[model samples]
Target: MLSLILIGGSIFASCRKQIAVQSIPNMPVNYTIYDNSAQAIKLAKEGMLSITNVEVENTAIGYGGLLVVSRTITPSAEDLAYDLSCPYEVKQDVRVRPSKDNSFAVRCPVCGSVFNVAENGGAPIAGPAASSNSPRRMRQYRVIRQPDGIRIIN
Candidate 1:
């Protein structure tokens, strides 16, 4: 009789559903990393625009937010837009230096996940992230060209 009761209780508990909810930021992060138009133009000309590292707060959804600097890749230029988030583990360790190959790629310093910046920083040809259980892809931001500079937003 005790065995039967225990089995029923176990089954009931197993049937219960568990859900987790996370708090998300209401307002978009407005980063004016590029002070003016010249700076934006300079970045466009250079082909790569490196911005001052800013910490992003929201991290529960997928990957942590990032301080993305905005600049336009000319109308004729092939556009490559990527979020600062890392695809493998949702978020990457702070201070991971994105690769400088001009291929728009970023390498996770901690896990050595090489992301192809060309395709929203997706998993690249080789890296530890290649064998990860979660085959995640990087977030890509929409790029819009304004009269003054480029705008990257959600």
Candidate 2:
């Protein structure tokens, strides 16, 4: 009986879901965007932006510079930010871009993975990303609402 129980436990452990573990750049990220500005206003209306090749002070962390994909749920009220690099590829240059059809999805041109950014956190809806066994969602950052603007922290 003891041997059977041990075998069953081992089987269950082996069958457990595998989490994708990737190296994340550990640097301080403090980005701010003020409301009532032209860029902010436009972002409010569109609700999304594909920021690429941002030059942060520390290039050692996060793919060369900072590549971020941002979205606003309330359009000037709430902001959400995520790293744009595709988890499938660990490099920083492989970033995701917004779909051309105005869909709420971002596609990785490298691997042809489409992630639905319109929902809460960036979720893989289709393509090779959807089939990934680990690191399912895009890496997300912290967005905080401030009195004047919004602040993103990494």
Candidate 3:
């Protein structure tokens, strides 16, 4: 009984650890990109976009906006979507910009933290995001793939 309890506790703790990203100010988000849209085309080609299409759906885009990435045309899983806000900064204005050279990683101009995007899990890979005593990953939103479009919500 003790062993089983210990195992369960360990599992829960690990899950918590994975979720220990710093919090950004709360902002509701509900955005969609239709299949025929330019954003969709870019995603299908494994390109990334920093989207701030506010008022499109009467919803806030995200804390600092949205960073959407696609790894495949017809991905088996979700197309990655994350809040542009730097988790290390935890402010709506402090956004992470994707590196011009690397489409799969973004760097915070303020904190110099780099995060892996797309299929890479949005985890901090370098700089303060990784080197901080309490390291944090990027804040991700749910990417729901639909027949007509991709709906991202937070």
Candidate 4:
């Protein structure tokens, strides 16, 4: 009887789930948008990137409430990726704000959940975050460079 109880307890513990957010997979797609790298850096430095373009932002909201922004790094001009999804909940209403460390992150005003953008921008850092699930992963939009302009799509 004692051995059976121990075995059962171990099994239960082992079966516990891990809570983490996940994002859509990144695939090769074409996006026709402004390739102004300076604007991206400006937004990063400002600690906030608003969606002035309703069409673009709405498209993201339509597709799983997420959008990927691709920026071209200077000198190397390497591409950097980001998602517009709120890591706390699957809601398009949430907006990203800068963390105390000056990093781009999202804060769900409704739930007060903070998500860190530095680590892919989908993992909850503090407040009412899932403690059990897979490791939080954000969806990435594949960015392709074209001679005419930069293509960003997922």
TM-score of each: 0.53, 0.71, 0.77, 0.55
Which residue segments of model 2 deviate by more than 4 Å?
Answer: 1-3, 14-23, 53-77
The residue-by-residue lDDT of candidate 1 on 28-71, one tens digit each, is: 43333243755456555665554434434441222344423223
> Per-candidate RMSD vs. true structure?
9.2, 4.0, 5.2, 5.5
Query: What total of clashing residue pairs does each candidate reach?
Result: 1, 2, 0, 9
- Number of the candidate with higher TM-score, 1 or 2: 2
Q: What is the lDDT of residue 83 in candidate 4?
A: 52
TM-score of 2: 0.71
Better of 1 and 3 by lDDT: 3
Candidate that scores best on lDDT: 3
Clashing pairs in 2: 20-134, 63-92
Tens-digit lDDT string for candidate 4 (1-154): 9999999999998998765656443433333445466555554455344442446433432233334333321223334344554444555455444455434455656656666544443567666653434555445455576775545566
Candidate 2, position 63, lDDT? 42
How far out, in Å, is residue 150 in model 3? 0.3
**What would you estimate as the lDDT of candidate 3?**
0.79
In the range 99-133, model 3's lDDT, one tens digit per residue, is 87676788999989888885555788888888876
Q: Tell how far residue 39 is off in model 3, in angstroms.
A: 1.8
